[model samples]
Target: MMSFNATLRLAACLSGALFVNAACADQLDDIKKAGKIRIAVAMGTPLFSYLDEKLQPIGSDVETAALLAKDLGVQFEMVSVTNAARIPTLQANKADIVVADLSITPEREKVIDFSRPYAALTIIVAAPKGTVVKDYADLNGKKVGLTRATVNDTMTTQLAKGAEIQRYEDDATLITSVVTGQVDAFSSTPSNLGEVMKRAPQKNWERKFDQKDFLLGIALNKEQPRLKAWINTWVEAKLKDGTLGAIYKKYHGRDLPANVVQL
Candidate 1:
């Protein structure tokens, strides 16, 4: 029963909406046109992202993000985020990509897409040498500090039965808890535990056990397939050329695993 004019008007409105959606979906083209790429980096995570003596961000992730922008011929813009904020920042479209040490997990894949892994990390439980924490069973009744929403937290929460789990917002705070003796033990990457050990060597902090070896992938919104594909290809190229391995070794003092680079 609609008149010709009314039908035409409805059609025109729908057409405009579709055009807008298409434009919004083309993030790859948008990034190229804008000449800038915003990457989310989580600060306070040592050897990944952290502040230097000059209060400037420096780490493997920071350098990797810069390398990505340079390779793309775009200006690099870092969007500082906490581990808990990385996915939310990408989901909100505040960043073009997340270059933080984001572990690839099934729960995360349901919400966002991940490029092939460009790095890897080992999750671990650490306590003073006197603590005698040989395994998860040893954590019973102990207070374990962890950075909230990280792979370390996930593994510890699922495995460290009967232990009181304390979550911190970021790595620095978790390290602080360990140094202040607020936490009897903590879960984090080996590098992060090393940072703690340096701050309190008198306590003889040492890794108790390894929990999991997680691959780090670049995260982006699920809608940006083009961007994701480009990232995957870039990661492969970087891996083959040894650029990523060099960066990892520069901070971590070891080469990337053969299996990881071959992947």
Candidate 2:
């Protein structure tokens, strides 16, 4: 027994919800019709997404995105992005999916949906072998290099007491700063550090300690439930078949760590 105004309001809300659902479905349909999936991946992230000697994009993220598009029976068009561009590209409808090392967190979940984790990351502190960084506590009062606005930066800023943090635009710059003694040590994930080691094993950097575990996922627009579900299924199947592990080893030169998040 609702009043007329209340009944009208409820009907309007329901209509609006239905319209929204219809619009989302249309977007997905358009992508299928186009026969291509635009994947946004982070640029200059070595071992994740970076240009190889041939000036071609070749990295774990790039390969993974290409695989996904192939599975979808569409062409893969890569959209090079930056760390901050991850969500905006999807929000602006400029990309169909973002495979840019996006970590699933409660804060980000409010704006976008994430597929099941495709990779896991462990941040660590690295310094020259003889450096006195035996543990996180030893980082206090020392200069630590990190990429600005990354999870490593946030974790080090929070946990390493009194450490003077020098933020760089990318890991390449941070690695240079670390080697040149601009920073006492560098806080980074293993993927980035592996690239550094390959380029300069003579540096003799040692891992001081591990920082945190982060699960990386494919980020989708919040309204695209169908796309998200498809990606989750795709990831699960690939993980079971060892496709993902092979990709990790291809770029990283080591088997996928056993610490990866289980699907």
- Tens digit of lDDT per residue, candidate 1, span 10-109? 4544467654444434578899999999999999999999999999999999999999999999999999999999999999999999999999999999
lDDT per residue (tens digit) for residues 94-190 in model 2: 9988998877777777877788888867788988788878777898889999987678877889888679999987666777777666878899877
Worst 10 residues of 1 by lDDT: 1-10
User: How close is every model to the real structure, measured as TM-score?
Assistant: 0.90, 0.84
For model 1, the local distance difference test gives 0.88
- Best lDDT goes to which candidate? 1
What does the lDDT read for residue 101 in candidate 2? 80
Which residues of candidate 1, in runs, are more than 4 Å off?
A: 1-25
Clashes of 2: 0
lDDT agreement with native, every candidate: 0.88, 0.79
| Local lDDT at 15 for model 2 | 65
